[model samples]
Target: MKEVRLPTIPEIVIILGAFLALVFSFTLFLDLPIQLALFISWFFVIILGVRLGHSYQDLQKSIMDGITNGLEAVLILVSVGALIGTWIAGGVVPTLIYYGLEFIHPSIFLLATLIICSIMSIATGTSWGTVGTAGIAMIAIGEGLGMPLPLVAGAVLSGAYFGDKLSPLSDSTVLASSLSKVDILRHVRAMMVLSIPAFVITAILFTLTGFVYGGRNIDTEKVEFFKTSLQQYFDIGILMLIPAVIVVVLLALKKPSMPVIVIGALLGAIWASVFQGIDFADAINIAYKGFAIDTGVAFMDGILNRGGIVGMLDTLVVIIFGLGFGGLLEKLGVLKVIIATFEKKLTSAGNVTLSTLIVAFLGNVLGCAMYVSLILTPKIMEDSYDRLRLDRRILSRNTEVGGTLTSGMVPWSDNGIYMAGILGISTFSYLPFMWLSFVALGLALIYGYTGKFIWYVDENSPSDETEYKGEKVANDY
Candidate 1:
């Protein structure tokens, strides 16, 4: 096997320039608006890629590859948009909110938010879907309950990410497991050693905070009005659930995503026409451009009205740019260089673990996309893990705990921005209360450095020279 070497000095400088440009673009202290910063960053990346021996054709190819890599994510995101619209059009979200408000005490709302999202994420295998829908509802319920916005946002993020890390349905989970050559189920089970403890600690903290905050008076009448408006606009029923069920069923069968999402969008349109009395043209329009309801309630408008291809375009754009940058870094060997420099210094299992955690975290901070971070980090660390005789599951878990958890904490990152925008809370404001994410990272680091729960491959393990019971067990790990 041929080993890839680190970057040359010029390549390092180019990589540094890309980082600086991205930082300058997103730096609030620089007094540049976010739009301008993003534009500037894109410009800088293009110039830097060209200077680093990438031709226009290469850049285009990179963009195409990046978009292709993210196609599944993109389809899921768009389906999520339509799903949110359908859920609203069918009154599913409003019903959840109304019922949530009735049952949840204000003091425990944050904790409840986390638990609910965690359950939904686990079931759906999609943190993004949980956030875009149930997460949105939770934010509204939190506001009605008078809980602090940041705390509510933090709790929602904490729960959503917990599921993303452990859920078999999650793309990040699947990606990590696949890249590391681990069975998906095994990967998820192995993560329990670290994930469960982090979740428990986070839940406890949120529960304590909820008790400290106490309950508040909610506007029952206002919530009732929103519920009434939804009921009036759309036919609310168990049948409205068909679209979600179909999507899940398809995903479970491991079908390609684009066709599934397209079907989902069609189902949304069909539901709108059949149940809401919307004309075919209007239903199609709503599915593509989002639904608009004249509920005459501002807060209701904020919560109940969302969906469409247009709504997902921003996130899609970000995914494209982020992945493009990551691909360029990979091609230039900049990421490889950094990982090699760090790997050479790690002599013990403890060091390898810590280094993996740090690498994962840095990838999140730099790439801000969980899949990008996972893909880049593992490739960089694969040889190191082999040298240390560490089980691949450990590296996979570390990557997930670091990348999937921390991406939502960085305001400028894709997940962070989406969570903040959807929840109507700033990432900075909610970051302090996002205890689970930080705790996950901390636990990973501790596990890495202390070797407390680090699993290693056994040297005395049998070779795959002979099969046992019609199966090869020696080479399984």
Candidate 2:
């Protein structure tokens, strides 16, 4: 097979034009609100997509394909929005917040936040869900306890990403495994070598920080106020468990995501009406406009009073634009050019591993989405790994470490932007405490260079497994 070449001048112009349009849309933030900014960004993306190819018809076709590829993700986000809205209305989120306050002490709140989010994200296979729900509450608790906002945001992000890296249900994880033809469970288990260490070190840092900042008195009044308001608005019963249970059961049964999420949204609406004294019209409104709270406690309100379809629209728009940007790059063959450049330089196991890390990082930085990073990196690096006789597990782990871990560190990236916004901290503020991501990257590089944890197939004594399972083209060089 011949090497894929870089895009010509015209292709570069199209790519640059799309990027500039994205920047222009973001500039709307200076004048308009966040929601409006999102709308503008997506509109720019659509226009850019239409102009990227040969003719208007071709551009329209590309736009349609981009939308089709993103359709499932869009539905999932909408469902997630409804789930959050109803969960708030049904008092599930509030109950979690109320109970979380009771159990978590200020001294170890950071570490506790990490653990709780990690568990929840792993269970749901969604870092975003974990962050939007428990993560927001934890940030509130941290503020009430007098912890620095940046540190708290960092802790929440660290835990949430850990789950995202390993969860079989995660879209990025599934993409990486599927693209490489590796077993999902096997890929997850193999990732623990790097992921576990990063998590442990992160926990230790958070624990030590807790001890350093111990004995600060939290505002119990705020906690009480949230609990009261939640009780006032909703029945607050175990029946709230129905929607959550349905999501879990359906996911466990390996059902397609769209139906499962839609059902979950319906259940959320049903529960909101049954328990929250919400009329059908009001419930529908909340599902779209989101529930509002003026708990009078600033931090608690920031945590508790967020949900609805409208609230999720910003994220949805970002996802669509990012995916569309990636699609255009793919169609123009820019990614293939970038990959070929790396293939020429990667000769040893160490180089292959390092290149994989760099590719994953660059993908996230340029592509601005974890799913895009995961999809492109492995495809680019597969040939390099084969030349070094490396196992696919190594590529899988590298992609997770770089793609999943570093995503929250990039300010313009979805996770980082959301975390910074929710925690009321600047992206730069929490960057230092994103210890897990940095540690994971460093560990991957070290292991690759030292061959301490690197796995490879023996070239001299190989049996019948000469061809790598997912290697589409033999590396003739």
Candidate 3:
């Protein structure tokens, strides 16, 4: 038997640099499709692993394990497609948009979207769910109201991410907290520090921007035409909203997002049949193949002509390739080596927090999943924090913010792919508008470097060091 060796820093850099070069060349200069580019990159990484000492069998296992861990997200994503299909067909989404377009004055549209999405995300604890459902409807309404697609998307994402980070029900929050051995409640409280200011600042920015665009001329007749058309196709009534409500209730009760979303999709199908009089065969088709809405109104048609399990197929393919590559990288032990290097190099106790945040951001960017980064960040940094007498909760908070908040910003990342697919917009289009991401990252960096709100170890009891609390916790948000 041969003893395995870890990758050196130079080898790690070479592997990562090659991967990045491939990504930029394929996605940027060559203008190749992302799915194919990912496949090529994965091949390169796999070959690199073999060039080292690992066998094909080991790499295969890593790829399979990566796929396995991500299966839950895959299923939820597919169900989200089905949910969108049925919700639209059942008149749920259109109904929401119908009211939203009419009542949400353009002046408050962006702010309202941010607030609504934030509430939904916090309740569901799943940003994907919030995006597929409320986020989708919000975009349609924004378009109908003549707002820019990217701007609306940015608002939705800001609120969705904020709520996702703050929500105790959020899977990422739980994973981050549990990985750091911090209480989820404690983590949520800590996040409030940065969360409050970020949200407040983001809200302020949205408001200032709103005062300019909110009063724009609205197309009431066009919007009303959309509502009337929606009524003609499906039963757009209070009853159609029941499925959406059920999912919210179930999620608030802390039921796992998987079954809750499945139920929501199935209920949408049933509602389409029971209330809208859709045929059983057509109902099944809507969930699987999605509906093709052709209302003579081009804009409304464009909004409606999306969703179905089939629509999510492309996004799912991207996830498989991304995670497959991430899995291989994790198996290479490159991240482990890099973390050890960071620990050895950092001299200032304060720099520990900054390094943890930086590594956490890189984890989500490179690892392809927030769960992957959240888990890895703590394992790599917990020892470093303990040695510096930093409270572990601080580490947990930074992990959530850096990892969860940044995932949506990376174009090739899982969160990025899912949001782009569901909203029918490019990830780059909305990246700049993700105010929460910018604000949270900025505040975290400031707090870390300034030693503001950073709690330290009490020499007497290292284990019980949270006695001193930092006033800020946007970390969880």
**RMSD in Å for model 3:** 3.7
lDDT of 3 by residue, 1-477 (tens): 455677788877887887778777887899887778778777777877787788889999998887776676688788788888888877788888877876888888999999999998988888888898899889988887878889999999999999988888887888888778777888788898989899999999998888788757568786777677777776766777888888889998988887888788889888878887888779778989987767787767777777898988877887777677668878887777887776676655457767877888787677666656776788788888887777777888888888888888878777887888778789899998999988988888788878877777566652632422333332332
Clashing pairs for model 2 are none
Span of 10 residues, lowest total lDDT, candidate 2: 468-477
User: What's the true lDDT of residue 348 in model 2?
Assistant: 78
Q: For model 2, how does the per-residue alpha-carbon lDDT over 270-374 read when each residue is reduced to its tens digit? A: 777877777767776777777777766666566666777788776666666566555555655565666665667787777877878787876666555666677
Q: TM-score for all predictions?
A: 0.86, 0.83, 0.91
Give the 10-residue window scoring lowest on summed lDDT in candidate 1: 462-471
Superposed by TM-score, candidate 3 places the C-alpha of residue 167 at a distance from the truth, in angstroms, of 1.7
Q: Candidate 3, which ten residues in sequence have the lowest lDDT sum?
A: 467-476
Query: How do all the candidates rank in terms of TM-score, highest first?
Result: 3, 1, 2
State each model's C-alpha RMSD to the native. 4.1, 5.1, 3.7
Comparison by TM-score, 1 against 2, better one: 1
* Preferred candidate (lDDT higher): 2 or 3: 3
- Candidate 2 C-alpha error for residue 392, in Å: 1.6
- Stretches of model 1 off by over 4 angstroms after superposition: 1-18, 21-23, 26-63, 217-265, 460-477
Give per-residue lDDT, candidate 1, residue 344.
66
